[model samples]
Target chain A: MEKVIAGKPITVNEEGYLTDFNQWDEKVGEAIAAENHLSLTPRHWDVIKYLQNEQKNQVALSIRRVGKSGVVDIKELYSLFPNAPLKTATKIAGIPKPASCI
Target chain B: MKNLVILGAGTAGTMMANHLHHHLKTPEWNISIIDERDKHYYQPGFLFLPFDIYTPDDIIKTVEEFIPKEVSLIKSKIDKIVPEENKVQLTDGKQLDYDVLIIATGAKIATEETPGMEGEEWQKSVFDFYTFDGALALRNKLRDWTGGKLVVHITEMPIKCPVAPLEFAFLADSFFKNKNMRDKVEITYVTPLSGAFTKPKATEALTHLLDEKNIRIESDFAIEQVDNEKKEIIDYGGRAIPFDILVTVPTNKGDELIERSGMGDDLNYVPTNKATLQSKVYPNIFVLGDASDIPASKAGSVAHFEAEILTDNILHFVKGEPLTEAFDGHANCFIETGNDKALLIDFNYTHEPVEGSFPFPGIGPLRLLKESRMNHMGKLAFRWIYWNVLLKGTHIPFVSANMSDSGKHYEKALNE
Candidate 1:
């Protein structure tokens, strides 16, 4: 599945994210980002420090072979959106406040 | 209790917030949206603004209006993300912790990346349509300006809306014509691409429109510098393209936040699983929208698709289940070809843009890789759809997250 570049059939409900990873343009980014050198620009480093300094328990993932994905966060999501489903779905089975994501 | 903290309240973040806020358990699960700005600009409408297709009020909206009210909103600048700590530090000295952090933080315009782009002529003879002020300013210049050499240039590859430059050229031709200056203005399109676009077939189709509109094109012209004083744009080859009005698509870079995190690419984009929207450096951190390094157009539709898949996978991660969703790099865009018609192209990672029908196959209300009035209306109507359906995180009835092949002439993947 990782190697496959096939576009799968999809039917999104009323609300969803903008682009699917399968259809997003990360490779295009690699082709482009590879052309840009950050020898003088220390912006990437700033991101690493800023993102890490904020999180208390970031769950680390592997880096892409070329390192060109769009967003990078390093924290366990549990602490971030504490009110999300997998955390309390069983315990709070019947509340109707709708504070978090569906 | 679990928390889902989504960073950046742009198109991707907003949609994910709405989706999860509606689906995730309440009280026990909290969904918070964090962003730096208070106003939301209908980005796609930026393209139309310079051409007078949309008014300022039409494109501007309060960010709070589009964000789901149920989701707690944090109007603060992110100081840094301490992945090791699973928390985010705000500029205000406050702290927000998350259980599952979704980084939908999008891309940024790196105007300085190009050697001469940031020089004197910036916002003068030189301009960018990527921002609201830039677009609005260009509109005023286009309205009263007498015809001369109008150069629509692309500083490099991987900029958002690959077809936008061509659309700008096409629409400019129409704009001048409406202003009774078409015969007076000499239009030229300069790009770093080997041709009109990355895709060969679409390039051939779009290149024809350029020719038909008498729009001169300079391909393979890598930018060297912007000689703002001389009002000239020089290519790496030492060739210079002089212009009276220069509408340039400057360098596009990932957010500075990516650089702060130190987990991004040379251009400051994060490294992630191309298909999973999962962070390449952090499993719990997922990515979507213009932020990813995926090889596709950085268009609104692409973000729309990825956010859906990322939302589902985030759910799977919470359950300790393997993510089943796979993104195929599907992106679709409507290229305004002037004369009240536009071209539609739909493709994924492996497939190139091919001629076909969309939404409805044989009876497509919208054609693919072909120019038509319907597509033009579709492009115009997108502004309305973006504000009402897209930003609200509400789904369009027929459009799916994945690219449909029913009507497309799915040639064997060329760039595969």
Candidate 2:
């Protein structure tokens, strides 16, 4: 189904993850973060940018990798998005859901 | 010349197929394994599902991919087992005659057994992580759910992966803390046991971890029913604990077919000689995995260890030789403690988890009953090993099926 985020039709899978990466922007990220009851901080954006860059390179993201990424450590990443750091972070970053995530 | 039929193509059944195929000569022994489903699940991955550490594809694979090509893979639901006649009846009215039978049909979460557990609040407010569907549903639920009272509970003991509830509590603490809602979410670790775990030493260590995380421990809580309207879990003692969201490990019971076959105990688990893994009533039938009523944790590690012994015993039984090898109920598990750390516990029927180094004793590497980052790495690496090695019946080096006391700290307990 499609969700209208800031008047832009964004497609999502059955699990409510983004289907199209192109449809995501700062406004869409804000909307997604709001749904998860999170207000993305600068730290969260750093993790989001790291995830988006890694996704473009088709690299798998894990807690250990994120911790060593130089952008943000695992502890700080977890603090930024508590529910599920990699999952929630990727969702708001407008990347396709990581296959490693169930 | 003879037939060996194994029911349920799960962890034990799949391994047995690969192991026995190599051990038993083909054409002389017709080996067949049966199950209703085509997919095999990496059950331990269920714990990581709700946490989004593992995806659905990471945990599931086709059963045929694991079963040896030499072994006959029968895709059909079992109707009954006629032990006296050495025949198993299928749902399609097909009766398969066997010289020997192995029951590996594992246990499942019995949610309906608890009153009001599967009521209107099921999958809405209350959920289970024991099943693939339940795990996926919980993933969705936790995705948008804000901070509140999160209860990680177990309805009874002897459930599969007994430490998973504790792992969930630990991971939830880390998860909520990462979300910056640690204060908003009041986490509770509830169980039917008197302490945090079944074993005393492990319980002491685990309870301390629970304390450190500010997760309340509600021990010895035997839930009578779930009052979904009020979102309260009422115990047998009339104590009620309210929760905004409940993640439960429901009562675990063997396949219903075991009940219908009249070959199982009260919980539908087969009554087998604990050491031999052979059925007490019928000599030709053997039991392994969660299907057997053994005093071992129903984890994949136990099944892997049992499979090694049962394979040797089956060959002895076929040759009319005495079954010599005994299964010591060795169970090895890595408990995820959150924050990129986990604890490794290795114990058996005769030994309790102690503080020491594993494999090499005091030399180094994985620590027993102690939390460490290496242990967490081991936990993550196990998923790869499970898929590539364990199911293929390959022996993991240095790790024997029996518990080793070498290099372990046993002074205090042994002196007593």
Candidate 3:
């Protein structure tokens, strides 16, 4: 199967990323987004999952802030936040209701 | 028996070498400059080289070509600095004693500080533009490659020329469009800073430029390591950024020699008096440029201003008098925006970049707090002046060592 992402030659064996962490880049998360038609919310599960695993890249940049560039979240953007937003928030504040949407 | 020996003949050392040559009375005072290499580079020009604006020949020249005849030039690597004995040992096993010493043996790029950054992706897929070789390598890659994910990442903070990465992103947009490969290429700028830049005003201005170019910005990315096997840069939180090409600014640290001498801070930078360029531990030792832990901007223009004030302070120090010359962190850089336009901002230690007219208040050949084609042209013109005027310690008209408030329309500015 041709990988959605470009296959890097740095891997140890013929398999996937079970070897080391240094081989990771934002392109892996981008492959997941590309499978869908650029949908950032529900279709962005792979992005958030990878972000939650990393923890350092959590701050959300404002789209309206600069107004010059529109950057797609090509990395693990979901877990980079404090928690996912209420629309995508894993845990809802003040109440414990299993909201099926998130 | 008083002699001043400076280590490293880079921007800071060369400026001080010229400044001292002019200020100090000859024969009575002897100044010597030392570095391992013979060539001196105009560091600012490295950013423009990838775009075919500057040639490699335009940026390099022998260190001795700039040094005045009166100031002695020694080409040798420093083995270690013996601060307690007031002597420095050279790599050739020769020890040179100094009555007064200056440390300008600036910062170095340690990509090894991060995991996998220097691995298989280095230069082949990942690149750096800080060095001549790095810039040249990227230039060759950009020349032929069709395009894919172009990630411009800053691994950590306190890097040399912080804005160059953003400039690269802007220039790449202009470059790819010219090549008719804009659609094939996706450009993203990643940094540890909260916004597009360190200062909020400049960040706001720069962030706006990123949007205009359709370039993406990823902020607060503290790289834990480069996941080479996955072909990604993974964070501590497990976030990953995969790159078709990674142009990274690795973590900058003071020279390793400083660390060996046991005279530097958490980084290899020496503890310095921010106002006066004197070493905190030793009275006779002075530090400048990226070698010191000064809060000033780490650019060639900053070294130019610091050299002006430091010459006077060093004179006072020798006479056993109090140091009077105060180094105002006076600095300004012409921010190059693509499409033949640039922006200029003037600020100091206390002052943040404010929007107003520069040098001249209402009427200006150059505009302040805004971007103009004229400002962009000025950025290009500075290369000529840097070679002819700045290194020789000849003062440019209106660019005082101390930043002035007269021209800026501060009435519109909020009262401090």
Candidate 4:
């Protein structure tokens, strides 16, 4: 589904995670973060960049992986994005939520 | 003769050994399987062990019993796999060179990964049913214990037989009901995921079942630590759920041998070409079962399907041909949902299980995503089949290695 984010139409899934990474930008990410009541900071940007890099390289993202990524510890990640850090961060970064096989 | 060494004689390795032994015979290729353990466990039986539905004798069998006589079974602990040298070093100061290596070491619960999990109250109040010993101990504990807060928890995702913990909770409800103590126990199913399952349809069905059974669900809980003294599991989000008896599935990781070889991801799961089952770093090395970091569920049904495809791929690789047959991550599992009923789900990499018929598809017999007594019967009958047919690489009747979409109900967009 396409929704207006940062005054531009962006494709997103039902959960508001951007379906197309190409539509994602710093402005779009900030807008998404603001939706979750988070203001983008340098530390948040670093983690977002790391997540985007991992997503680009086709590495599956998880809280465990991000904690070990050295970009941000899990505690700091929770503080950065508040509740449901991975889900909120992935939404802000325009990546798919890390899913488990059912 | 060229050597093909298979590591671990568990379900995957045993099936592979049986599958390959017929195709790659004697003087051309020498097949050898190595594992430190002597007993071959019917791992699914571990779920029923705690409920006393199955005894230890029913699950434990000699590993050699399943292996073909033509293949060499090396009983030794592996120290490391030197992929660069194409050699597997044994702990007893021995090494075996292999032209082709199939690593099927599988995944195991790592209690050490979670702090306070294996602490003072390790098996007293805290228990795990993932292993034979753990299940047996839990059985003994459940025999005379007065029930209280029964927390059936999963510490992380990608655990083996993802439905087992849920089944444990379901069976627990019935078990207590049978013993006239249903009202005494408060059952809670805690998970890292947002619902009863990962898939939308299954989660909806299962979540409803949990509700019907009066089992409360605490979802999206990423556990930080288990407070042994307080008898509560604290999550990273500062959510603490108290438990009188915590039957938890700790973080499952691939064999440490993968990590020691420096050929694994963070969880020690080897990176593999999901379609071909070939190690991403080494073409000659193939990873099967839970050892590989595939998006597929780490279950016996998955390994069973993989053995069929990997067998064909191995033959193709040996003949200097491109691996054409791709494993679609087809897994057919029966989820036991208490009260002599179960839900059979057939899914692959892309497909989510929906309501339909299985094996015969449109024909009746086994239903998918809907609980039935026949499905439960199928689950029980699978034990006999696992030992007698599946381990021998015999194809199950009507069940294709690749998932069949003919009998399944799928939305047009998802049918692809």
- lDDT per model vs. reference: 0.73, 0.87, 0.74, 0.92
The candidate with the higher DockQ, 2 or 3, is 3
What's the true lDDT of residue B46 in model 3? 84
TM-scores of the candidates, chain A only:
0.19, 0.92, 0.26, 0.95
**Residue-level lDDT for B379 in candidate 3:** 88
Stretches of candidate 3 off by over 4 Å are A1-102, B409-416
The number of the candidate with the highest DockQ is 4
**Residue by residue across B1-416, what tens digits does model 3's lDDT show?**
46889998998898899888776656678888899888888888889887787899999988899888988899888989999999999989998999889999988788987889899778898888999899999988988998899998987667777677888888889889988999999998887655788665667778888998999988756676887777788764466888888889987889988988999866678998878999999999999988887877777777788888888899899889999759988778888877888888887786667777666776667777688998888888898898898888888898788888866755534343
DockQ of each: 0.02, 0.01, 0.04, 0.65
Query: Residue B252 of candidate 2: its Cα lDDT?
Result: 88
Q: Which ranking of candidates, highest DockQ first?
A: 4, 3, 1, 2
Local lDDT at B306 for model 1: 83
**What's the CA error at residue B188 for candidate 1, in Å?**
1.2
DockQ for candidate 3: 0.04
Compose the digit string of candidate 4's lDDT tens values, residues B79-162.
999999999999999999999999999999999988899999889999999999999999999999898999999999889999
For each candidate, C-alpha RMSD in Å?
15.1, 22.4, 13.3, 1.5
Provide the lDDT at B127 for model 4.
97
**Cα distance off (Å), candidate 2, residue B282:** 0.6
The candidate that achieves the highest lDDT relative to the unseen native structure: 4
